[model samples]
Structure formats: C-alpha cells, structure tokens
Target: MSKIETSILVEAKEPDTETLLVLNDIPLDEQVEGLIRNHKELNITRHRSEKLALSSGPDPTGLKILPASSRQRFEESGIDVSRGYPEVPDRSQIPVFVDQAFAIRNYDLPYTERGKNADKDKKSLFGAATEVINLTKNVGTEIVGLQLENLTDQQKDELALLIAERVVVFFRDQKLSPKTQRKLGEYWGHVEVHPQTPQVPDLPGVTVIWNDYKIKQGMNLNYSNNNLGNWDATKNPAIGNQVWHADLVHERQPAGYTHLHLDAIPGVGGDTIWASGYAAYDKLSDEFKQLLDGKEAVYISAHGYLDRDDPFSGPKKVERVHPIVRTHPATGWKYLFVNRAMTRRIVGFSPVESDLILNYLFDVYEKNADIQVRFKWSNTKTGYGTSAIWDNRIAQHRAVWDHEGKDARHGTRVTSLAEKPYFDPDSKSQRESLGKYLHKWE
Candidate 1:
C-alpha cells in the first residue's frame, strides 16, 4: 500500500474573524459550490494557497448556522469540521438521490488520517519479500513466495492485514501440516472449535473434510443391504452444498478468518468462489442503503448441525442478531453481512417484506459476477497443498459440488472467532477503504 501525503489545513484567519478551514488542492466547481450550499454553516471562498477556505461565524451573509442534529450526523459520518468537508461529487457522478438529507447522508466522506500507516515496514523472515497477485478488482489476492510453516510474527501480521483487506487470499504449494495450520490460524485470533462438526482424531481443533466418492458408494451399499431408501437420491449431502454463506454467523461472535487447505481434489472440478460483501453493499441504491443503515437480521444455525440436547455442545438451535450491514472492525469498511445459509429474516420487518428484501439482496452475491473470485484446485496431482485464508466477516463462499461421486475432494478447515458485527457510520466501503492497496498491486 502507498502512503498518503496530503493534509487538511484548518486555521483561524484572524482573532475575531470566523475559523477558516482550507481544503487544499481540491477542485471547487459549481457542483461543489452547490453541495457546500446544501450544508449551512459552510461558506466556500478562494484562498491565497490555491485552496478553498470555508468560513464559519455569525454574519447573515457570511455563513448559515447548522442545527445540532445535522452537526451530529456530519461528525458521525467522519466529516472533519476542523479539516474540511467531504468532496462533492459532480451531478453525473451521483448514484441515487431522494432528498438533500439523503444525499448528504449517503456521501462517501473522507477520514482525517486515512491510509496514514499503509507503508509501514513489512519485512519478514521470508527474505523480507512477498509477491501479491490481485485476483479481482476488490475480492481476492494470491500471495506467493512464503511458506506458511516458516512465517515470522511480522509476516503473520502482514498476512492478516492483507487477508482483511483482500477479503480472501490464496497460497499454492504450501502443503502446511495440521499443526502448522493451527499455528497460522492462531496468529490472527483465537481458533474456533466447531460446536458439532467432528474434529481430527488427534489434532484437536482441526476439522477434517473428507469427501471420497468410493467411501460414499460403500455407505450406499450398506444402506441398500439394510433395505433403506436410495442413499444417492434421497440422502446425498451434495444436495445442500450450493448455498452461499459465511462460516458460523449464528454465533454471537462469529468466526472471522477461516483457513481451508485442500490437500486432495478432483481432476476437473471442485472450484470455490467467494463474493465481496463490500461490493454488494456499495452497489445498492442510496434509498436501500439508508433503509438498512441501522437494521439488524436474524441468523440461525443449520438444523442437525448443532445438538441442543448435548450438554457439552450446549444448544441444538443457535441464533444471533447482527447488523444487516456490518463495518469490519479492523479496516473500517462496511460489508453486507447477511447470507443465504444462516440469515433467516430481517429484524423489525414483516415476513413478506423480509423475504422480498432478502431475496433481492441475496442476488447480489449470486448474480454479480463482477464482485466474485473463483479459484480452481488443480495442484492436487502434484501433492502440493493449496490453501485459502479468508475474512468470513466480509465474504461469502460456496463449494462447487460437480465432482460428486466421481472423485475425492478432501481438506481441513480452521476458523478464528472475532468480535460481534456492528455498523459504524464513519466507515467507508471496501473499495474506497483499500484503494491504495489495490492500486499498489495494480
């Protein structure tokens, strides 16, 4: 990521005169002037420094006064009064407009110290060098040249930041062991233990995802010997594998980073795709965005995935309420947090209304090819373990089940739980928040 080298200068011109806040090196055309006029208490004028100075005081012709509510909303949206107001987009650039209040509310404001530490020292044990390949404009990045087992503390921290920014990062030929994978997951946060899924017999927290076509066939034979219904047609697990979802969203504090190591895969299939929540949220109209600003949704764990009767597991039915749009705690970017698998309904909405809104929102993940990254696992024949680490807080993924009953696809998964989801008005969208990083690699 590149360093930001700009500052907003706010200075008092004279003792008794109004405070003059200068937004340096920014264009001030008619559209900008009109936007400034929309916000009372701000008056724009040309400055000697080739900047636009906003004067705030008490003359009727000088500056209009802002009400307390407007000031609070402005501050909450990260508009720096001492620095300068957010840049006004041209008429052609505005996406949607309902009212002046809605326009101002949906504006993408600038942070006072945005991207200040983007260029910090990132040297690590891997010769202080790493290669990054962006897979999409906003969703995924592939990092090469570092062994996961040999990562240093600095490298781990850097990788965490990259994964958080990119949403998902892929590594090829790492062949990380279960112990090493557990260690790698620990670097980001506390590794989660699935409430009901079976773990590796000897490896404690590692969950084994063993899918073998031969083994399934044998199970079906046994079911036939017992005169049970057709296992392939009636009880196939692949029937329910197409849902797009984030891991463990039913928990109060859901899993943040989930690492999946595909050690074995089919020859031609078993590709996984992830969609960016930030992109989904950003593509919504301003009216829908405002409608979902502070709304919450209900997420319920899949039935039979949890055992409420089991004292150790605690609950058979698990449910939690999270913001419909969540701001990632680390990067301060908003993301669409609801998903098809766990999210059941929007809170405070009628069932019909919830279904209508949610179905449309779910299409953002399912239909938007521009906001997705698909990765195919083709390195299984070489015995090189391919791994994907992703921020479940800001991404939704689905496994392609086309290889069912034809080949084996096996892997191990580990998830790290993070803080509960929330919406911060000051946070930007992922693309805007990670613009420098994306541009650096581009």
Candidate 2:
C-alpha cells in the first residue's frame, strides 16, 4: 500500500502529567497527527456498535460509556466517576419516543385551534391561578403553589386530570390539618381505609402507614395487627405495590387516586419512584404488542400482606383477573396492566406457560425504569404536613426507605376514588405520544 500524504502536527498548549502519560506510547509531537489519521475511523466503528446495541433484541447486560472529555471534567470537579451511571434512557429523548408511541393511537380528528376568548368562555376559579406546573414532558408535574386544604370541586377534578396526565404530581409545604386533608380526599372520590391500617380517630381518610418504630410509640390495635405489627410500609410499601401493577388491581373496583401526606420526613435520602405503564406500553413493537392483546392476568394482593398465614382471617385478601392490556378511563389510552406486587399469572394458561409470559411482561416493565420519574423529598418540609397524589389506575409507585434511622419520618395516607379497576376494552386508544407537550430533559 502507498503511504498517504498528510500535514498535521500535535502541539501541546500545556502538557500535564496525565496528558503526557497518554502520549507515552508515541512521540508527543506526533500524537495529534496519529489521532487525526485514526480517530475518525475509531469513532465510526463505535457509532455503528452503539446503534446495533439498540436492536440486538433485549440483552439483559448493562454497559455504559462516558465521553473521555466528560469523564475528565468529572475528575477535575471532584465528582465520583466510579459511582457510574444507571441504565436509563437519556431523559432528553424520552418525550420524543413517548410522543411517537402516542401518535399511533391518535384519533382522526383534526387539531382544533382555541380562540382568544377560550379562557373567558369558562368560569374562572382562583381568578387565573396557575394550578399545575408541568414538571417534565413525560415524567412529572407539580400542582403549583396551591394549598389542598380547601380546593373547589372543580380544582379537585383538575388535579385528578393532572395526575392522570403526568402520572405523578407533587405538592410542597402543605400544612393541612388532618381533618382538612381527609376532607380534601373526599372530593376526589370514596376513600378506603387500608384493610390493615387504622384510621386516625378524628380523621377518617387519614390512616397512618406504620413502621416498626411507630408501633413502639403507643400505637394501639387500631393500627397494628399482632401479625403485621413489625412490618414497615416506608421500607417497602411495594410489599404490595412493587409488583408491576396499578393500586388495588385485585379489587372488583380499583381505586382512582391515593394520597400520602408526609408527616415526619428524614433529614436526607428518601424519595418516591414511579414509572408509567402508559409509557411502557407505548414503547412496545407491533409484534410484541400483538402477543399481549386481549390477554388477562390474575392479580392478587397477597404479596402486600406478606403474612398470608392468617388463614383464619377468612381470606381478608383481594384477588381478580384484569386485562393484560388496559385503557385509562379518562384519557382513553392503553397501558401495560401488570404490577410486580399484584399481578400473579395469566388465567387459563398452564403454570409453565403463565410463568413465561408473566415474567417477560415483568421484565419489560422493570427494564423501563429509565422512563420513570423519581421525586426526592425535601427534608426541610417533608415533615408531618406535605403530601402527594398519584393516580393508581394509570401509574405505579414505590417509596425509598434508604434513610432508616438517619432521619425518622412518618405519614398518613388516604386512597380516594370509587372507580373500581375495570378493563375498558372499548377505551383503549392507540398509544398516546407526549412529544409536543415536553420540556427539555436532563
């Protein structure tokens, strides 16, 4: 082969020890010349490999690469490079992907243009108050700067839709009295007392989700069963919810929304995480989805109430079979309808067959954790006051109890909404993409 002619020279503005070490295999003056000749080829090969990684069909292995320049910056800034990256979708691209998925289910209706008088056409409450701040395009929204102590019925409805849309909604510094909190929950729908939880004597909707430490503080039989007394919700509320699922999916009628009011929060490191079933379903391939249509999975809350040995309690448990694919009642959108905690198996299938299908679905849901949004509690106010509302029908959530004993926290939760979980066969709209409704991702 003939040697290619080129004119390039490496020049160090200021050579450092690391920089010199990198060039140790070659003469410093020729480093740039060598890179110019070879780096472009190396980059092309790497780009091709990364693109192929996306489609080799679901490899469970996790690998991540950070640009050398970015890695160097982290080192210079005293950041921990060894801490590494979690396997997550880059947030910036998520909205685009979700929006694309939603586009598949779009109705043929033409887009309507709202008139300048649109705001005037409707009765105004709070006189032009900004009730919801879209926190992220695909993950979260915060009910802005408003107190839940006394919202109008309309506002409550508005909050419900926001939760349905964002999947998770947050409120801060809310100092509602226990009575006020319970009353607020009433507006959303019927509130249910967790079968194992005890209601505060004065506030019917507010039930304390107890931890072991809380039981020691003179909490009576009203809240603790001798069997479940040592169990902790904060450590693993998913003891029931962890299964890829919607809340109370086993009940004849699943709940609409569940609210958790943080009473006492630790100083640091407690957060709640949620993933979108809507988003998860939206990301599937046509072939993959074809396998799920019309399927039904049996859901049971036995996992949540771990000590199922109380055979004498006459099955104080909830079990039902929900459609493997579900449509959101209000939004009319389809979503994956399995939960890690509640979904047990596919009905009518042999045990081996059920295991294969359910595990695949479970793996898909768990892998999509990248599309989830995590809300870290602010210790300053995560005290006996602040709360959050999540639409359990359309979303799944988990609490992080990593702060055990670091900073003691407690809360009262109220689940509202009488809408039993039902498979809306006719309500499934094609996947709804959120592309246009997004903000910049992290």
Scored by CA lDDT, what does every candidate get?
A: 0.60, 0.51
Against the true structure, whose lDDT is highest? Answer: 1
Model 2 stretches astray by more than 4 angstroms: 1-132, 212-246, 303-317, 379-384, 424-442
Error of 1 at 287 (Å): 1.6
In model 1, the Cα lDDT at residue 311 comes to: 24
lDDT per residue for candidate 2 within 1-442, as digits (tens), equals: 1122233333466664122213345444344334423333212111111211121111122113332432333344353425332122222221111122223212322211111123322234334445656565566766545678666666566656656666778887766565666676666666654422334433445665534233232223221232231132212233212223456665555566788876555557567777777777766765667677778887764322111233223212335667888766556677887766567788788998987777666666666756587786563342225677877766776665556435645556787654534455565433434333222224
Give the per-residue lDDT of model 1 (tens digit) for 1-442: 1111122223567885554343444433333333333332332221111122223221132112222322343344343433322222222222111122122222222222211233233445224546768888868988777678877666676677677777898888765677778877675666766422334434445765543421331222222232121122123322223457788787666778889987666778778899998888887866778899889998865432112123234223345788999987667788898787667789999999998898788888778999899998665226467889998988888877666536656667888777757789878776666563332221
Q: Score candidate 1 by TM-score against the native.
A: 0.63
Instruction: Name the 10 consecutive residues with the lowest summed lDDT in model 2.
Output: 44-53
RMSD of each: 26.5, 25.3
Model 1 misses residue 137 by how many Å?
Answer: 1.4
